[model samples]
Target: MFPDHTSTHADTAIAPGDDTEHHEGNPRPRAMTSTAEIDSTISHPGSVRINVKGAFIVDSTEQPATPANGNSTVNGSYHEGKDIRLPNHTAVVSHIAVDIGGSLAKLVYFSREAHSTEPGGRLNFHSFETDRIDDCIDFMRHLKDNQLALNGSKPKDLCIMATGGGAFKYHDKIKKALGVDVLREDEMACLIIGLDFFITEIPREVFTYSETEPMQFVEPQADIYPYMLVNIGSGVSILKVSGPKKYERVGGTSLGGGTLWGLLSLLTPANSFDDMLEMAAQGDNAKVDMLVGDIYGTDYNKIGLKSTAIASSFGKVFRMKREAEDEAEDNANVAQDHPQLDQKVHASSNNATSSSQPRGLNDMSSRFSASDVSRSLLYAISNNIGQIAYLHSHIHDLSHIYFGGSFIRGHPQTMNTLSYAIKFWSKGQKQAYFLRHEGYLGAVGAFLNRQPQNWGRRGSFEGDGAALEDRLRARTSEH
Candidate 1:
């Protein structure tokens, strides 16, 4: 289960040369206005490593005046050959790509500060809720417009490459908002390609997690092929990645991250998926889950089933309610002044039900504690997915299993549950590893699909081809 990690690193080549260029416009210097800070990592020219400590700023001082209506002025106001002085007097060359999905829209764009002193290119990653796609469009449009102003060249007609369900579902909306043509990419292809890039180029981008042992980093091997990828996004998608641009949808499950969020939200007051996961880490699932010991009164050692093993998730609720009902019935038969009966009735209904049945056919207040419900639901889905993934891996003889998607998000319990399930199922034969940027694989895949087939092994993005040049383009002025 991949939760939501957002670290992104890009390999870029900044054309090193003189950056000073003459311009014509002589408008008065406006006061520098602060803008929203973007989190980005720039790789040194021709380097694969990402320098996380260095900051790359996209100077917003050159933005056009806010229109009277508080909107970006019509594209007509922008004309070719207009010298808009950029910060450091260097042109910023950026190519933008995106993957818009049911829940989130991911963006991976490259930018280079036009000076040799700033040697590398900046690869910035951004995301927005799919419902707020307009925000994504606005951000891209601003970048596109800025790119135009920097070079005094007409915006290139590069189609914005995209993948995921939203690519088709919201095509027209994106086209209208950004004025850029939308190029659809196969979702599976995007995922595989993105996985390839992470495995091959990004260092320390994958790792294995287990509760018993400390988290260990899984180094990406040069010959690492034929691994099973279990992506837990809204739903799970299992792929057998044989090589670059080579994969097959071997198996999947409908109950994935979407299930966890949808189900847990109903039982808990958590306002977000992260909040639910945090609550789950503190939860004691033993209170809500029926364990083997709870039923047998001892370890079921004959079958090798531990006493602490879960017999039925959320199973204790029914048993507790039945016991409460029995006590209530017995109390009715007893005298009204029977002090012991009153105490038993009150204790069973108040304490037992309160702890066991957080939400049931009874009062809303009877709903299970957020932590317990969260922990149970998290395990329920993780175990289910992990078991299925292991079974598939066993059948296919696949040794490696890398879990990616927005489900694990580096949550210790979720990863531990997934790792434990795989370990238990494989019986020490295999383990579950996770990606650093589990959430952005689809978007990264879309970005990589624009590259040539053998581009991954070359370890360089230039000269082989202009993979993104065709799709990562600016829209033309309609008027």
Candidate 2:
């Protein structure tokens, strides 16, 4: 949402099927039902396309109902025509890409249609909490009912792709709610794909580090060779990008945004992620987090890792003298309540975790006001991911890193933190990148999976009749 994090450069390829020569009508392959095959019964295009590389989820249901027909717009675009053949059989791609993170469940969908002249079909995107599984399911149903009400579309065909821990946990509810197919992608895979797609697609997508000056572009191609894909969503994961298609998820810690989100929710009165940012913006994390001096008593300056770097976030919560905390609280109250003290503090110009984010961020500003807390959590997760990625990259001798997933979207500070951490850890040897459309990777992958071999690559299309006749002529002559 903000400017790019300062840094540099990236690459990916996703093509389906074998060749450009397609059967007269068999182009977009509807993912065959579990038992069925490509044969006599189904012979039309499907409205789903996903690029496996990024597991990008793209839902394109071109509904033909315009002012000429009857249909309402959904998510700004109209479902043009579900079934051009039957006119009665409503065709729609109502897929849900639910990314259950440690803190929240990011559920995205397409539930309505647009008949207007504006391009890009009317597809809606929405989400809810990870804990509210039932509500998320209900929301999906509402989307389905809305689609069916507008036109009797098949709930069974609704595309449902899930990742993260809850994918397996809440699988049944999703299928039962929509009577559709549920696809499970590895959470790590989804994160990588999502990251790669977003960076390549969205030009302005970037995170900032070092005062936001000379912000780094979310460049996926300008790589040093093989690097790491550090996804800090609900949890944290690291994938070493080796080659165009070669990558290995080295290792990751479960301690990430989920830990931060859960802890903040319980320890403080923060309601939303934004609220947490607001509070952290002013709150003093040093009061809570454990510093290096608390552990070593001196600067262990042999390695650049500082003593003041949070040794254990919130460790001080247990060690602080209760009297000091009480007195500090009294002083803070006196300062704020007394106005004069507040004015003095303001005049001195001291900034804490409250509103303490790197410069050049959007209005959202990093995750909550406890920016120190947020920054600390980000460092813990991103640092771990980056170090692991560096290990894998060194082992495999690869040079590109793409970090993705819903977590990155909600926490740009985390992205910049990860980027800077990776850069610093590598001693300016490696870098990190972020994506714009963070969560659509798997959904787009699912969508592209349905197209014919020649469908994905541009300029490879064969016309319905004339192109077929010319190809047949060439084949017959050769025979």
Candidate 3:
């Protein structure tokens, strides 16, 4: 699945349900027999296929083991037990919000403990590939069924709040699978709303990455206006947020996460996005990228270019063409010398793919390892996005530029690259901050749309922003 490339930013509210609530002690859904089958294709790069059957088993015997937090663990996901509950299970309000993109589908729902009337619960997050919509639908159905079975508070009408392009595309499919109406919300509005909520509520949500030092959590700014939100998904969208419900789509780039994934699939054997990022962790981009030193035989001090600075991405591949050709010839010679071994190797490669990927290739380049290609691509994309973000920040006169989206996934190299780019471009006048719940921002924003009024507003929170900042600063130092 890929990101929704359609640029529609209109707010459309289709359906709204009663303020129904949910109580605890419901039957949770379990995976009866879930299995994924990988396609055995070597010619195609992104041709992975997954097949799942009989998912969302609701039997008590199939219930998963709960951790100390009293939250169920499915597929290694551990939700904390901070759920709220209403007394007597009297018409509980259970709201589920979804943000379906091209590549991934994110879900955020609220759950509370029994006999609790407060406006808080365990905000759970789950994600699956957008192509695998059935899997997500199954999970949502399981949650719905579980809620109905335990609470017995069936209402006359029920709908799941959804956002993103996938919401409109899969509207009918989700309705059929979940047996509930899908209320679509505006994608960009939901994203900004979500960012505002977490950055204010969660104590350890936003952090700044300063060079080689450990990440320091940034407290919520009291006058949190005029900040920029740069969400890097399949593509990038830069929103200049001035205040609540007041923002503008200042700029964006077509070259973003999708570009990186597309190029990486062509160069590396990594099938999944995360696997490609892992490869980059152990990679040396210097081997694949032509540096200033490589071009000038020394640092171009007159232009303030460091010797190690990348002159051009993937430029070394062409610059070192002679060596690459020699390596290719050597591999060809080895293959010819052992025809039987070469055939066997090709056969194995055809049948095997990455653990979570779909395609397999025996064509790992002899000139450069997968790690080198991965790192080069990573740097190339991150640096490009960072530079664009910095330029936008300068044009808009914005100081804080927070980067979020599924592409980041807490990747150190990616974050460091963006941080370094901002520092270099702004001359330390600005900093790049990342969110702990980066991928779920849109989904959370959609969920907040269903919550009580003023729930996501700045004035709703009662606290001294400056005092909170000082407290967080002290906490960071102690840690």
TM-score for each of the candidates? 0.67, 0.59, 0.68
The candidate maximizing lDDT is 3
**Candidate 1, residues 51-131: lDDT per residue as tens digits?**
222222332322211112112212212111111121222222334568776666777754454553544444455666666
lDDT of 3 by residue, 163-215 (tens): 99898999999888777868888899889878875564344467877546747
Model 1 misplaced regions, further than 4 Å: 1-94, 112-117, 145-159, 301-303, 324-367, 451-479
Q: Which of candidates 2 and 3 reaches a greater TM-score?
A: 3
Model 3 alpha-carbon miss at residue 281, Å: 1.0
Model 2 residue 151 CA deviation in Å: 10
Single out the weakest 10-residue window by summed lDDT for candidate 2.
1-10
Q: Write the per-residue lDDT of candidate 2 for residues 1-479, one digit (tens) a residue.
A: 00112111111221222222212112223222221222211233222332112222232322111122222233222121221111111233445566665555655554333453322232234445566667777767776666554333555546667776777888888787678777776665555444543444333444433436434444333333345666666666667754333457677777766766777676556665445544544565565678787778867688765766667865764444444455556655665577776656556665532222321122222322455555455455555666666665566655556666545543444555666666776677765655444444543333222323232222333234443332222122111
What are the clash counts of all predictions, listed in order? 13, 71, 19
Put the candidates in lDDT order, highest first.
Answer: 3, 1, 2
